[model samples]
Target: MLLILSNKKQLLLQAKSLLLSASFQQLSRSSELTFTCHKISAIFKQSRPALFNNLYLAMSTQPAKDHTEGHKIPFLLDDHTVTTVRESKILVILRGLPGSGKSTLAKEIEQKYKENSRLFSADEYNIKPAIRSSDGGEYAKLDEDLNTCCERREANLIVLDDTHHDRERLEELFDFANKYHFIVVILEPKTPWRLDCGQLKDRNHWKLSLEELKNLRPALEKEIIPLYFGWFVTKRDEDALRKTSQDFLEQLGNFKPFKKRLQAYGYEDKHKLDLLKYFGKTPNILHCTTKYCDYGKVTGSEEYAQQEAVKKGYSKAYTLHLTALFVTPRTAGARVELTEEQLSLWPLDAEKEVMPKDAFPRGSRAHITLGTATEVQDVQTGIDLLEFIKLQQAGGEREDMGEICGGRIHYYENGMWMLTLPRKIELKTIFSGYYGKAGVSAPQRGGKKVLLPTCQVM
Candidate 1:
């Protein structure tokens, strides 16, 4: 799926709708949250940032803080910087050597807050010098930047990926957290995944040989291994990251009502809604305004007036369907009138509509005299008549999609259009009495039925 990050809703909804209709394997629900991304960064971009910042305050929950698990999840960062955040912040700092599974831990943070957080990566913004391992200055700048971001007062979940060598550098981070009053969790992997650096040498994708690390390994160990000195714990698994983020948010607040508001606005019960609320309340339109405005039923059931189309012993699909098309003049305007015969005989412009010259035709006594207005009938036009009292159900294609010849016209009530179908042949004759040219015909809908409001000059 193409990423359309610019219009979040359009991108997410359309993609979700499309995906729901298809069958796929190896699905990671978070990745499927299809939204197109623009290069521009607003406050809300970067993984439901608004929600993360509000992790501890904005939303309030029922039992207050969730301490059932015995301990509050810790927040930690390795950069020597400080900061504070509001309601729902969950800060995680991952410190380890390059191959010690820091990225994997970072990914777990994203999965934990799948609805509310996104992973911020170091490699993505790694300076050119850092990429080639040629300059220490780039890494220093990056460390400072990461430290500064961790100090933010609005981060929902900030996970830092870096190496710590001593208390001197860690002090820079501790000092900031002290001023900002943000909690820091110290994390260490218990069962780190070990990779055979040598194995990468023989693969088609490898760019180096097994002998290369012999020289570089010393520098890496000096900068990285000392950082894990006494704090080595093997419990920083994927589950650990998830449990930590969830516990942090729960302590911050209960988000159910907020979730309801989002659901009403058609937002999925996820982190997007939590962020959306934090950003500001979004207005909700009537459900019909949605692109696919499908209700249980709209308009009415229009079936052909066919009884014997299907014999008692025959199939139901064979039944003739007659549509009872009831339409109101979207625009009630004036027009000239002319009889059918007069219209046929007149030298009128083909483009302009010519009404009946005579309001009431010779054959019927109950003629609908549309004064100053005209009702022109095509072969598709017909009328339905009910017994006892004559009820007319107009059946045919409307002249214009939303326009009608002017003079006088009907209006629909509360946008509700109803129709009564006839099953037997006698019902067809009853309709002919009121309409004169009575017949059950199939419905002819012009243009697609759109959710946009009906347009009329009046």
Candidate 2:
């Protein structure tokens, strides 16, 4: 028996070497030989189980080249690359149906943040899974607990685990986050069987039926609030625009009025204004921002995105006519003139939000930020444009400083300058949402810096 076992091991080792040396395609070219080979392989696998198992394990564990490149699922947050923020508060809201693994994800997040995180769950508060009149009291207590945490600044990362199917409930949480200045991030589970009602019926602790799960799906499906909705510039157009913007900036630097304004703003070296460095490199994709939905925390964000016109416009192409280029002390951008058809995607109260009392047209604030000044955010570009519009409305000073780069320049108050082009520069763009990364860092109110490994933007 010992001699037979030794011979079997020797034969298997030789077969392994042969298998490694020859490709399966090469071996399978001969039909008769292939059939014989399969028979032999099956015999070895079935009879010599111990030896074959080792061979299988070794072959299976061999490293292969990764082909995914840098592409990642936009909604999923990687656990390994999670970062920590200093003096910044984060509110992570988990939304999903019963048995959708929200609790499991919340626990994982809690473990990752450890001491710096506080997790709130409906189950802990003895709140029933279904929406009911009696459940309101339990939910109120949960909110109070969360409020206390935010008030005392007890945790850097606060996680709320619940179905969150109700829009009103989400609104209440958004209000709390806004008041406390906490960055809100809404996450849903990435489990494959999350929406499979049959699987959920078996997996759910509540033992919810398929009917109940089906009813919940509609509410969640109707609204999907993105990070921010806007028109994305194509790669080819973006390159062209970059060059065009650079040329405009160069000519403006040499202009005498622009130079005179810079000198007034304490730029002693008129030659060294360096408009390129003054307005830093664009951080994100060049696009006209429509609505800044801070991850579904913004008021009426879901409803707005679900509007028929907005929904139809999403991912659709439109040619934006660049009417002018404007520069403020804080930002530099191109003013976009939306046509009647394009104005359908524009939010009704877009301008009213900026100047509530003033009655500017619906698409008055439509502009793409070419660049922003040091320490200034990209959102300021829209605000600056509105300021320019307000002054224009009030009949503020507008000195025509002559044409440069086929556009006439005008100077407003405090280094505010604009170049209105005679011929509109048109660029094709697609309406979409920006979900790249969360910019949640801000000045710390007062507390120790907490290292949160899982508080990442989805």
Candidate of highest TM-score:
2
Candidate 2 lDDT by residue in tens digits, 244-274 = 7777777787787777677544576455576
lDDT of 1 by residue, 169-250 (tens): 4455444443333333434332212124453244212244456533333433321111000110111111232232222223
- For lDDT, the strongest prediction is 2
At residue 196, give the lDDT of candidate 2: 78
User: So what's the TM-score on candidate 1?
Assistant: 0.24
Candidate 1, run of 10 with poorest lDDT: 427-436
Task: Report lDDT (CA) for all predictions.
Answer: 0.28, 0.68
Off by over 4 Å in 2: 1-224, 269-271, 436-458
Global lDDT for candidate 1? 0.28
CA lDDT for candidate 2: 0.68
Give residue 12's error in model 2 in angstroms: 56
